[model samples]
Target: MNERPRGIESVLVVGTGLIGTSVALALREHGVTVKLTDQSPGAVRVACELGAGDEWEPGGDRVDLAVIAVPPQFVADWLLDLQKTEAARFYTDVASVKALPIEQARRLGCDLSAYVAGHPLAGRERSGPGAARADVFLGRPWAYCPGRETSPRAVAAVLSLIELCGGNAVKVDPVAHDEAVALISHAPHVAASAVAARLVGASDTALGLAGPGVRDVTRVAGGDPDLWTVILSGNARPVAEVLEAVATDLAAAAAALRAVSVDDDGAIARVTELLRRGNAGRSRIPGKHGGPARAYAVVQVLVGDRPGELARLFQVAQDAGVNIEDVRLEHAPGLPLGAAELSVQPESAEVLAEALRSHGWHVP
Candidate 1:
């Protein structure tokens, strides 16, 4: 058989955590030779064991491209040293924030011509390669920031890499990237964490009453605090700037609640409007990778844990000429009843609920 084209053949992935290992797996799936390394020896070993990449030794033969997925604080310094050693002909990073590292690179007198800054806007609350998914970046937006010293070839290489991993590339200035993510991504993490922290000292009985709304709101709070501390600390100024606006809104809420005997209609209206704004804002968050948000119909159903209960319910939906887009099994183990939140087209939701109810399922 003829040999494959050799341009940008070998790629090195530094840091074999969730992001790094995921990148390696995605590249390897494209038949690209991937070399994986990490500061944690066990992590590297685990990544290799999980088929992320071939084991890589430090100061080895230079690869065509190097993707550094280290934490934000270390990216700039690491890139500087790698550039000095000519570790790779082209370099990019997967750090959430970009401007600080880019500035640090320039200060270190590294050849910026060989580097590009990139961020993949995809992650789970979980950390490490064990949580890495090959399709993690599929259809997701990957931001690219080209420095003045970055070469056209390097930019192209990174773009191709993003595409190979099934991500769409969006170019923006490094500073803009940081600020945008501060609003959309970083800010949400802090908000989720804060909300979750408030539940820490709550009574067990109070916590037992938690529902899906609370779970969804606090989901990202389960993320590694150590990692989040680095991310928030690295982008402190931008994140703090966004938080100040949130604080102002919160203060307004507090003042409204404290107003005694005053006609609180205006304050109540403001709160309601704020909640409405939240619904509008949340609807704009791209669904699954630039797709329309997954619209769900809340189907309140009484379900038993008996065998074939789920299968029978689904069969009824299928028979009703309704397609179930997605299903959330919300049930407490050892309980006889549960609710299935069915995510379906708005048009089909009512039909499915009716059909299920007709089939003797208590679907509200």
Candidate 2:
């Protein structure tokens, strides 16, 4: 990336949370002066301490760009207030939903020509300054939604922001961006929470029998509920539409399961077809770096619970001359061994498994 975005020497990040700090840190790395601010002084202080950027000072030098990273509900008001000052030449936001904020800003009579809306389709299950990483946007798509009357300079500035963070800039309309995210992000979050919610009143025995399948489905459900509530509220319509479609599928699956349990005719075929459709839908998801999904082979190994075991496993895998695509670890209760599942390119799985066993590691 360029050392600094053209004509953008300094940036004022208006929130010090995860996304805000990440943007500041990434910009600072490329020689852009950045000022960090938040409603809470302590939050800004922590972000600064983490080397995201310098603390914002009153009457400081004006910035070339100002990024409003506040919550969805406060975005319009904050943008309006910032526009009233000569704080920045170009204004953009990292809010999850774009259309509502843009509409609100228009109603508030904000300078439409100087503003654009952007959202990075990336995040961790964690939140806050503590979880911020400069590389969070790498290999992610950052959607840029400029208002109809937005100027070329404003669009370029926001595009530079995305490039500086190592993200691909995907130009999209505000309404289209909202709908896409509802299907991919917002609705999935709600679904994950629903799956997790089922465990709240589950019996201890049922919980004990859970495995990676349950854990995977409910992982994002651990996110901050308060923040999710605000986001869901902001993009309520699109999210509701997506959830309604999902509910229809859920009803079909439920009815099929009930019919199968009763040995009804064609019940097995109905269940199988639903499962096949699920496989098809899941296969459409892009693989690493937005490429077509590739099937990987999993090689499971039982390793002793000892110091340096994981490092040794990796060393052996490297010695086998196979690249590992992914990995997972599962520990058995009251056992000294844990299962390490390594996912490699399908053609190399058996070779890697044999090599690991040849090196005295149990491969199952």
Candidate 3:
């Protein structure tokens, strides 16, 4: 682990949610004193119990940095209040949307020089302090938006914070950051929710027939709706713009499907083109190590529904000296066994499969 940044001996982390607690934990691990606070006293207590940080109290020594890990809508208000109190020499936030909060801070007459906006592009499907992991930001992009008026010292402090968390810091303008996340993060979340909403009226048999495809598409939809509502609404314009384009594509897809139902041969080409474009778009997403994405090969293993089955499967991969890039479990309704798809680099896939077979595991 890297040493804590210079002059940042202590940090005041506001809002002891997943991101806040994770930041506190990472900072505390690096010998930086962290003080935790939240509107919900219970949340702060939970985070403190998790060793994220000590409970924050007024009249404490001034900290070098103050991180506001609140939702997008609440960031500006906190920024204004923190400034009124001279909370820290520098301040930053971990809100997903940037432009709104920046504009709000400006409107509130807060000192821009003392504040830098930041967002850590890391999270799980779960939320709250219990789901927080100290290593969540590792190898992920932590974006910082320091406006023209933002001080260099503030920017440096935030960059150091990202470094302490073992994250790669990327500098971006606030407006650009908001627009980018709308397409990549915010809008996709809305689309996922829309797709998942269709399941509300779906027959039990239809839902039971769902495979990894549906599960993967709707996975993010499982996120807290109340939280996402605030996020989507905060970036409403950008998100809506992207959703409009998605609607166009969806309409075309529906028309093509309808045409195919009528046995129109030309509809197949249209559907194939849409799918091809999707493939091309997906391919453009940067992969690990900042290189063009490499397609991984998957080896499926059948595991009986019992304790330690997953642990045994992982041990098999560890013994084979194969690094699993990703793993997904798919279980059909009423099935006693589930299939675990272990994704590895193409060369390692065959090796992994062979090794699992030799270990008396079903690799089919």
Taking all chains together, each candidate's TM-score versus the true structure is 0.77, 0.79, 0.80
Candidate 3 C-alpha lDDT tens digits along 1-364: 2344566778999999999998998887678999999999999999999988899886777789999999989999998987788778999999999999999999999999999999999867779998776756754689999998999989889988987775768999888998999999988888999999999999999988999998889989999999899988988999999999999999999999999999998987887988999888877775432335567777889977653465556657768888665555666645778887776788998899998999889987
Using lDDT as the measure, which candidate wins? 3
lDDT of 1 by residue, 4-75 (tens): 423567899999999999888777766788999898999999999888888887788999899999998888
Q: Global CA lDDT of candidate 1, please? A: 0.80
Query: How does candidate 2 score on lDDT?
Result: 0.83
TM-score of 2: 0.79
Provide the clashing-pair count of each candidate structure. 0, 0, 0
Where does candidate 2 stray beyond 4 Å? 1-5, 288-364
Per-residue lDDT of model 2, residues 1-364, tens digit only:
2344656778999999999988887787678889998999999999998888898885778788999999877888988888887778899999999999999999999999999988887777678987776756654678889777999999988888887776768899999999999998999999999999999999999999999899888889999999899999999999999999888888887898899889786767776887898788777765432235666778899988653465456657778787665555676655889887777788998988998999899887
Better of 1 and 2 by TM-score: 2
Clashing pairs in 1: none
Error of 1 at 168 (Å): 1.2
- Report the error of model 3 at residue 130, Å: 1.4
Give the distance in Å from residue 170's predicted Cα in candidate 1 to where it truly belongs. 1.1
